[model samples]
Target: MRMGRLRHAMVCSSNQNRSMEAHSLLKRHSFDVASYGTGREVKLPGPSLREPNVYPFGTPYKHMFDELRRKDPDLYKRNGILPMLKRNCSVKLAPQRWQDNAADGCFDVVLTFEEKVFDLVVQDLSNREHKLMKTVLIINMDVKDNHEEAAAGGKLALELCQELEAVDCWEDSIDDIVAAFEKTNNKKLLYNISFY
Candidate 1:
């Protein structure tokens, strides 16, 4: 009964359309669909936490990286390969003046974090002079957006991470966010993180 309740709770936070379509597709194909959060309880995969696990880098990048490690090991590992020392540490959306500054042969992934997280990642990336790559991947996690879309957002699962939402709960207008993801093929992996 406890497990049953938990499963329902997990499902409840999923996208309605995506869930229904995925379930229907899986059933017809004799498959299954499961979901989870990417932060808190999750131990950063493969590689343990870096020396400064508690990022002054802000919440979004921290949570996003945590979630990435939980879901996509290879991608996360690639991320792990990037220069551990952040050069710059902040990002923002430029309206109209957005330019194509991306060059070739950057890191294995091209991405961005949300709001404050983006700011931190951008600042570090810019400071580094794109040492990670011509493009900097902003790692971030969605702790809120309690609405349908952000339902899969990672909640702080760490006892030490009690202030999960407090960190990543910023709302900003990053117009090219989805475009960046699509262009880079950087996917939002399942939140495999869990706590007993």
Candidate 2:
């Protein structure tokens, strides 16, 4: 039961589209927010479904944008990868892996966009020592990994965060907040309580 802005983390498979969109929106609202990927590497759509352009977690967004532009400017631009990379560059330097960010400090809430990412986050948190004994709310709201869906999901994430911030005792009020959010957004959210 603390009162203040809740620190948030938005996670997705690659942190290119969905997470970044939510991160950008949350940041705009002046929320203490960070974003991460659950995937082993950062992956962007390539010319074919089987061929995804992959980069290490630490690869700079600007570098990816340049490389993608050089590889096939028209293709990347048409697919929205270039624009996503451009937007990501403005939000953060690179995509970070969720498993590798344990030292980054604790977050009050972590919102993942997919069930697999939610599972990975839960598993990673479960393996860590509860040094702080601080509870973090991990919520998963399934959002399609696309530009349009990302935009809509970002708004919903913002709305949920607003509801959370309004409550003094979030742990006590979380169930109600989630229920109201689900009713309003018509989206089911899977949540877990984890310790830092």
Candidate 2 lDDT over residue span 1-196, tens digit each? 3345599999988758999999999888888889988877988899998998999999999999999999999999999999999999999998898888844968999999999889989988999888899999999999987899999999999999889999877999999999988998799999999998
Number of the predicted model whose lDDT against the real structure is largest: 2
lDDT of 1 by residue, 60-174 (tens): 4334444545665575456442211110011111101011122222321211213443343344345444333322223333333322333233211111112211223212212
How far does residue 82 in candidate 2 sit from its true spot (Å)?
Answer: 0.7
Stretches > 4 Å off in candidate 1: 1-106, 110-113, 131-133, 137-151, 154-196
TM-score of 2: 0.96
Identify the runs in model 2 with alpha carbons over 4 angstroms from their true place: 1-4
Candidate 1 achieves a global lDDT of 0.27
